[model samples]
Target: MNKAKILVVEDDRAIRNLITTTLETQDYQYHTAAKGSEALLEAVSFQPDVMLLDLGLPDMDGVSIIEKVRSWSALPIIVVSARSEDRDKIDALDAGADDYLTKPFSVDELLARLRVALRRARQDAGPAGSPEAVFTNGELTIDYAAGCTYLAGSEIHLTPIEYKLLCLLAKNVGKVLTHNYILRQVWGSALPGDTPSLRVFMATLRKKIEPVPAQPKYIQTHVGVGYRMLRIPEGGPAAPLGE
Candidate 1:
């Protein structure tokens, strides 16, 4: 097909139909699979440009499907599911899904995100990054191109969202990214305005990346504004994050 082929792997008939109708209206070539096995076949045969995956499947766990598919492809996998728990969302993303959208999403917002994700995937996998992909703060390094991050020489494990949030703040640097801004950019469009959950996640992240969990060094709190990534000044050696 001339249009970009999109795959929707959702078991719910209503949700599948909704997504298909939306894709058809947009003039996109699409395929649908109601089970994980069928979705695997679709992946091999249909060669979809993007995939919308639902976590709950009768035969296989969503995480397994993601792990299996990621073995070969870096396709932009945007998860579509009713599961709202933090661990559920984090598991999908950490398993290699590129984005997540909870249930009852607006069609317009989904389409906008679809366009953006496709464009970004292409740019990221392009010949050379527009601005390069490494962020360095003296001894600390985050090489996004390599899918690896390090402090001094050893690597650290960060949940997918953690890494994504870090990359966002690192890219912006001195800019104070507001709480809502952080939520929308990293979480999704549907996140509620009152974000105690976001604060919880941020606290967990700070514990992972702060020089002192009690007193953060690299990620600074801007009071009620938000957080900014700060560089330790020359001749001043800040303790390592997670120390």
Candidate 2:
């Protein structure tokens, strides 16, 4: 596989150096920008495979950069910021960031997240730029064309809403989907007091697909932000029929 190109957009000299050095250690091709304007220019000109963005840029807010880049490109954008609050993460994600890494993140974790984004990017750019007709992660399988889902090769029945939710997460696997984003996609809009209902539905959906709902291996809850569908490795035990 070709090493993914990365664009590092951080105004802090120290943090930029640190990230660039780490990328170098991994032999990754990278470019840097200290301001949002420069970041947008590089994003269009260089066309990096993935971007590491800092929410606080000298020229403009990082979320603005995300929205602009998203207008034309679907390349993975991972927000790396000091804004660890759930609201900040949600804002960046809603703006189209593929992932969010808090400022005090570990090098290992950052690299791991980058790899995941790259993998998703490659999968998205399927053979000759076509979207995959089916989605699979671990024991869960989604046949988009047939509108069916399976766990351990057993067809699992899902309500219309549950199926929609599962498909949404599967399509954006590895990327965080904020509550609002999910609501809009799954139910048409995020109505007031609907988040709580969404959570309840999610619980029932998990019970059907998770081997152990208490320790989910597929769908992950992000507290205030939203949910993410994890890409689990193949060969795991199948979802238990009964506890």
Candidate 3:
């Protein structure tokens, strides 16, 4: 495989130099940008495999950059920021950042997160003739690794959480996954108890797979209980865009 390309976007001269030297010493190809606009330009031209983005930029908010870039691309974005608020992390994730690291972080931690984010990004940009981790019913194909449904051979867009939930449901097939089970497994122990999020995610999944989202056919919600997938076919829907 070719060497991975990394973009380090930071306003601090000292930190930028430190990162540049570290990457160079390790023999990784890298680019540097102190502002969002320049970073964006370099992003498109440089074609980085992963981006280390600082939330506070001289030209624009880091969240804004993520939103704009995600409009056209799915490049892995890791937010390197001094902002430590949970809400800030959530905002970044919601804005399409794949991961977040607060400032004063260790280089080792950064490197570790880098591996994870890049792995996920590469998986998202799956290769041609990728193994079908799916079974179809009528018009839907479920990708196991990617966790998204395909309609008529076209890819369907889905939130990260929604994707996970989908994989859980699809993998089980006829097995019923209870509400608490889905919540605990997908949301983590940090978030305990009821999961309104699961409900919302189910609705989104139904919209993408069901011919009529209002009354889902694939994902059936068992009242006061959970959800189930009847029989997974070889693949999902066959649309223009592939999943």
Clashes of each: 0, 0, 29
The top-ranked prediction according to TM-score is 2
Give the TM-score of each candidate: 0.56, 0.94, 0.58
- Pitting candidate 1 against candidate 3, the one with the higher TM-score is 3
Off by over 4 Å in 3: 129-243
Q: Residue-wise lDDT of candidate 3 within 66-143, one digit each (tens)? A: 999999888888888998775676677667676667788777767756665565455456668253476555666776
Clashing pairs in 2: none
lDDT of candidate 2 over 1-243, digit per residue (tens): 347799999999999999999999999999999999999999989889999999898789999999999899898999999998988988999999988988787888898788889888988888988778888888888999999999989999999999999999998888889999999998889998999999999999999999899988888888898998887756753222110
Model 2 CA lDDT for position 15: 95
Q: Give per-model CA RMSD.
A: 12.7, 3.8, 12.9
For candidate 1, list the clashing residue pairs, or say none. none
lDDT of 1 by residue, 54-76 (tens): 99988898889999999998887
> Which segments of model 2 are wrong by more than 4 Å?
235-243
